[model samples]
Target: MFHAVAKGTPYSWANRYCYTGMFCWWGSTTYRRANSPGAAVDTGWGLKFFE
Candidate 1:
């Protein structure tokens, strides 16, 4: 997360690093562009780090 802050992370940037099992035990992501007119993706789930 610190890397995102340092690089002025863009919207949906983190989505690329997203994985089914990552460094976290459970995680989620939401997509939305600031000041943009469109529907934001609200799909997220509590997945495990290892399947």
Candidate 2:
């Protein structure tokens, strides 16, 4: 999905997660529909999620 978006005509990258947090505590992250590839997209806190 990420590759396709990056290569598609619009030419964009995908953000795997959105920033959700409090003053110093990070909360849940939401996936972005379309973000740019090789772009500086931050998912936050170096956290990992599994299905």
Candidate 3:
């Protein structure tokens, strides 16, 4: 269902590394500490890291 929502369309940046890495990193941090600050803000940080 997630894959279907993020189908491999050309403009699907989320289907690409931008969102992929963000969520992956987010999960990593959340796994370490669920109450981590700026987790949501880190999405933009992760996107910059990937790019």
Candidate 4:
């Protein structure tokens, strides 16, 4: 689905993280939704949801 966002190689390089404690949160390349291809473990920290 994301491969059609720009029309390039349908790919990009980024670092995404998922946390499940205190307040789980995720991070990635700020504009494009690159959260569909990574995973993370809980460290008992911050806020948000992960894909």
Candidate lDDT scores, in order, read: 0.45, 0.39, 0.33, 0.37
* lDDT tens digits by residue: candidate 3, 1-51: 123223456655455532332223322232233556745433122212221
Q: Name the lDDT value of residue 25 in candidate 4.
A: 59
Local accuracy of candidate 2 as per-residue lDDT tens digits, 1-51: 111222235644552333334334345654454566753544545333222
Candidate 2, after superposition: displacement of residue 50 in Å?
29
As for TM-score, the candidate ahead, 1 or 2, is 1
Number of the predicted model whose lDDT against the real structure is largest = 1
Q: Which candidate achieves the best TM-score against the true structure?
A: 1
Pick the winner on TM-score between candidates 1 and 4: 1
Query: What TM-score quantifies how close candidate 2 is to the native fold?
Result: 0.19
Candidate order, TM-score descending: 1, 2, 4, 3
**Deviation in angstroms for 25 in model 3?**
14
| Model 1 root-mean-square deviation | 8.0
* TM-score to native of every candidate shown: 0.21, 0.19, 0.13, 0.17
Query: How would you encode candidate 4's per-residue C-alpha lDDT over 13-36 as one tens digit per residue?
Result: 443233333434555424334457
Off by over 4 Å in 1: 1-6, 9-28, 44-51
Candidate 1 residue pairs in backbone clash: none
Per-residue lDDT over 1-51 for candidate 1, one digit per residue giving the tens place of the 0 to 100 score: 212222355556543443343445354765456666766555465533432
Give the CA lDDT, 0 to 100, for residue 50 in model 2: 25
